[model samples]
Target: GAGVSQSPSNKVTEKGKDVELRCDPISGHTALYWYRQSLGQGLEFLIYFQGNSAPDKSGLPSDRFSAERTGGSVSTLTIQRTQQEDSAVYLCASSLASSGAQHFGDGTRLSIL
Candidate 1:
């Protein structure tokens, strides 16, 4: 992908349903990150992956949230039993290295009804 690409730019789901969001990072980038931004709230880091290392899942809100990166490239985030509080913009970003600035995608707007 040129920059980062995320699927289903807008998603509307009923409460308790599950939703999966996808992200394709830029070529050759080694670090990928997922973040969530709620209305009037700052971006919150959800997870981070660098190469074959263990993913940093420190910021996932609950047990229902999970993610995985394949081949050190594309990534997917799944939210199970979605709640109204889950409505937010999920953003994906990638960097050449963990210490570099990240390039962000437009984000997936998930709305739990």
Candidate 2:
């Protein structure tokens, strides 16, 4: 029962650079979601994936943001061209199903310099 785990709990990168954040979901969970919480702002949904279905990318802020889940267990979020405005805590969560209550990870705090 390894819950969910995220890497580089804190990351500082220069603007315009690319950064990849990783997430490991709990075993047997088929729903995974990504969200971003900016300083003093509410959580914004980024993307969601369930089983082998097409990912819901409607919430992705821009083309610069993308994510992929492999084997329905691990996921990675990639920012192609980082910007100061993109600095936020990238949270990953998972649940038994898309509509179930999600368990959240501490998140990878990305800071664009």
Candidate 3:
């Protein structure tokens, strides 16, 4: 796919384990976003990167969860000491700008035991 790509479509890990999810955005897209979709929470924004700078980091749910974008192309989300409540579909999207239409990937379904 030439668009947003997320790896390892599904994952299962025990509580207290750590997990890392990857997202590769479309070429030349300067803005990338991460979101979480859960049965109870619909879509919750996690984080995003614009160019090589991050203007916002408020959407992250906790200190245990963090993300970084390197070379302004690939992004990785890391969750430490995972809990059952952390289970959800992690979605990745990219656009030309913050307000532009976003292109999304199939998402990574994470399950915590």
Candidate 4:
């Protein structure tokens, strides 16, 4: 895809379940970021992955949230022991550099029952 691409656009699961969300950044992009947006709220930075540097997982709310970028391309976000609070739209974005504008995906709407 020419832009950021996310899959499993919608997901439903139980509170104790675990899920994985995937993202494919545009080719040649070096910076990738993950964000979460709850209904009625704006996006919150979850994590960031930049070429070769250690992933910035500081924005993650807890240990259950994690992400990784492989070869500076595809990335995945994992949520363990999903809770109702975890329900939100997971957005992925990519840019040529950290300071440039980003291109975002449609997002994955996750629902925890």
Give me the candidate number with maximum lDDT.
1
Candidate 1, residue 17: Cα displacement in angstroms equals 0.6
Best by TM-score: 1
Clashes of each: 0, 0, 0, 0
lDDT of 1 by residue, 1-113 (tens): 48899998999999999999999999999999999999777899999999999999999999999999988899999999999999999999999884578999999999989
State model 1's lDDT.
0.95
Error of 2 at 11 (Å): 0.6
Candidate 2's C-alpha runs over 4 A off are none
TM-score of 2: 0.95
Across residues 1-104, which tens digit of lDDT does each residue of candidate 3 receive?
Answer: 68899987999999999999999999889999999999999999999789867546789999999999989889999999999999999999999974679999
What TM-score should be assigned to candidate 3?
0.95
lDDT of each: 0.95, 0.93, 0.92, 0.92
**Per-residue error at 93 for model 3, in Å?**
0.3
- Worst lDDT run of 10 residues, candidate 4, spans 94-103
RMSD of each: 1.0, 1.2, 1.2, 1.1
Instruction: Write candidate 2's Cα lDDT for 41-79 as tens digits.
Output: 789999999999999999999999999999888999999
**Distance (Å) between predicted and true CA of 71, model 1?**
1.2
